[model samples]
Target: MSQSVLPQSIKELQHLLWTAADSDYPVYVYREGPQDGVIIDLSKLNEIIEIDPANLVATVEPGVKLGALAKKLAEQGLRFIPADTLFYQDKTVGELFYEGCSTISSLKYGCTKHFLMGSEVVLPSGEILKTGGKTVKNVTGYDFTRFFNAPYTDFGITAKYLLKLLPVPETRKSVSVSFKGIAELLAFIKDLKASHIVPAYLLWVDLGEQSVFRTDSSGQLVMMEFDGLSEEVSEQWKNTEIFIKKYKGAIYEVSDGCSEMASKWSCLYRTTDKYVLTEEIKMPFTAQGEFYKIFYEKAKASRVKASLFGQLAEGKLNIVFAENYPQDTFIENIIEAVEQAGGVSSGKYGRLTGKRPAGILAELEHRAKIALDPKMILNR
Candidate 1:
């Protein structure tokens, strides 16, 4: 920890963080390979400790990487099952949580919001606010952890976080099956749920050409991964194979290699490789599938083609468009359709990308910034 760069006051901290046009912000630029800036890096801390060890709740400095946290827990035969970052070995906890970033596995294990238990954030006033408890049942007051996903950087600055861990599944497995269209995909998903497959991550990847559905590589190549006891993995894998066979799908790879590849599915969401890409938006999960099938179909037919991925169980979706025409209309129609399906759509995505055109939610977010961070010194 370099005291020279660390700000002890709120106003000073904000300035130190994002300085003028030269400073790097996650939204404007998430990563720059070997170089990056504007982060809460606590490199001095050798290791972070859990708030309540018996309860499996942890309080970690912002510098901890998700993979490192996973490793720490795995030593104790447990896990912090968040979406693994692309740069798992490099991305910091502060970068992951504060940058409002999610990984390839978000569809199953969930985003930061799901596993977070509490936090110790430095507010715009420079006061250290301690919030949330070690247990899931400790819902005494408003939860600050959940707020991490709802971007309003001007209102909050989280440095230390408390997270909940899960017992590592003794048997882990993945299965993939694909259909000709979205309709078939939905049907297959429904059947999987009916059969109680209980996948850690359920995903749909439209490669604009060939698409496979399986946790591992089968001949037809729909990708899937399963985790649990050995008996459980064997049973689930066997059953999944039978189910895919019915779909006339072929299985390819199996075992460890299959599990490793299943982790790559989320790579489709990466924008860095494409360069000059538009902002990625997120919406409610149920708002996209059968819940709003008509709307999704209409979207596909429209000029603006958006790719959709979801954490249906978590009620969230990550949407991105390959062709960026009719951007406003596309987003507007999607939000309207989502509202029709009974869900709230925030302009949180707008803030994460560091761009907004002064809409209703955008206005509301600005007001929040003014109210919570009147000084306008927080990272907005």
Candidate 2:
């Protein structure tokens, strides 16, 4: 059995780390599963330390939930760039940052790494290290803040973060359309990319005979959102509608609820079932169509149900599988298909399957781990 400790302050956390370091048992931050070793829960540390509106920066404790922080910031007519993605609003700032979560708006603002300006990380040996600053251009030495970008809890635990913020747009609107097939959708996406109208988010979802966004059509859906001045948003939407008509896409009559339902489109299939597997693949735009073709063929051949949703411009695709499907064989085949399509798996499946690259980079990472976590007590 493992013991869980919720440290309410930095002093108490440091003491816990120091005590854990002296023992032979492993110590790690508590995520969502059963684990061996002492677990530290940092949720009590949640707090919005400072919001510098003039500098467009927000200093916050690691445990602060993103959705709550966004609402607080909105009161001042400011917002965090990454919070544009509604699905991740419930996640804590530290949790999402550690997972390197990206938003549908990545087409416009970028990922969690881009929003992280600075952080205060606590190492396993009870040492507190500060990296970066409140300014956007704070790089005096090695970029230590990015070292924790991935879910690399083995490195250290982040205590506080200095995140970048943006001014709330005067207007925001979304438009939804459906395509007969992936080919037409890809063509339309290419055309939209070349156009001057850039959207906050342009998502492609394939629900396969199930309509979730109130669309009567069963084909693939493309939902786009534009945010800016009222006139700018309206003009961009008008041009987008014209593109949909040119592509022969059926434009669905969707409400202007940009924040509510638009965020759920990608995550609608997620469930608490132990057997359900969701994998995220990163690949070139040119390879995405082929990847999906291969994925669907494999899924159909195995008689397994699978659906996909992703950010079109970012070349990121998430595939969700029905519960109780054969996990090993299907995932192995899917990974092989992803490699064949010139894509890399960016989810847990990749790490579990040993798909991560090995070389000098791997050696450097191992050396860093040994140097910083000599006892291997952090996330052991």
Candidate 3:
């Protein structure tokens, strides 16, 4: 027979774990979020008081919010880059990682593994394990820490964690460059990387398609970016200007007016009301280029009049041209191309981060539920 496990608080967690036996049947945990979830929170038990940043590494109580960590780290001249996706600063890191509620900015920093250095996790059988370390160069023996810390809840319940952070860059900038062809844009990115004109945020705009780039009816477009500092960005901007002229591209100074222009690049969830947004499909950089060109031609051939909004900075291309057409066929076309051209398609944005097979994904999800609530006693 299988016994369900449950989590109450830190104190209750330890008390129940003390007598619980091993079980094979999975225990599912429901989170506080809309989607069902749960995890062991030891801070509530009083086993520990405070987990603070000691040196290069940080120890957290699992219930801490990333925003709070960033704010505190900022006091010491450090920052974490993320999509600013979190709705509030009060949510716990445990909720963020387990439920997979990370923002797009996390892409730049390398997802959970980027900031997560080490974790003190509580396994399903109530045994404690330590993985990874505080410093990049300090890993020892088996590197199981990162494995347990992933958003994959199939692993175990993460209670305490250690994170590694780098000193903030002296300069940070965002820039936009407009080009007629994808090839030209790639070349520009390559050139910038070679010249070391480092831009914290590098984005490309398709002047031909993106309405934000198109200034007038004549198809003239501009790129908007954040230039870091006076001296370094000046040099970088100059080099960018030189490249634009050689490539015959246009440059525009984007200022506060950018707030309105930035709407296109906003969060995908915001479009739920007005847009029947297709699931996000991910492919290699080159395949996306092909899909973009092909999709443009297909829409015209089918007389399914539409438009393209390009988020060049990120490798995201959105098609929103459908007015009267059944979206199923239009979406099917893209999915077909994606599969044929070596890309998998999903409408869910977060699925990309959690890239496991459907069967495996379900298994892991079930595991997460069990890891948080061992008795299978959460709801039942």
The local distance difference test score of each candidate is 0.54, 0.75, 0.51
lDDT by residue (1-380, candidate 2, tens digit) is 77788899887887788787878557767343236787788899998999999889999987898889989999999999777556666678877776556666888777768788888888777789988888756845777788754564367788889988999999888777888888888888887788977898887778556322344457878788889899988888887778788879987745564544465454442344633435777878998788777877887787777767788667888766656544667877987788877887765665434355467966787788889888877765
Better of 1 and 3 by TM-score: 1
- Residue 164, candidate 1: C-alpha displacement in angstroms: 0.8
For candidate 3, give the lDDT of residue 346. 44
Cα lDDT of candidate 1 equals 0.54
RMSD of each: 6.4, 2.9, 7.2
Q: What lDDT tens digits, residue by residue, belong to model 1 across residues 52-89?
A: 55887777766666667777777787767662322344
* Model 2 regions more than 4 Å off: 30-35, 209-217, 254-260, 263-271, 274-277, 324-326, 352-359
Give the local distance difference test score of model 2: 0.75
Clashes of 1: 41
How do all models score by TM-score? 0.70, 0.90, 0.61
Which 10 successive residues of model 1 have the least lDDT summed? 26-35
Q: TM-score: which is higher, 1 or 2?
A: 2
Candidates 2 and 3, the one with greater TM-score: 2
Scanning candidate 3 in windows of ten residues, the lowest lDDT window is 30-39
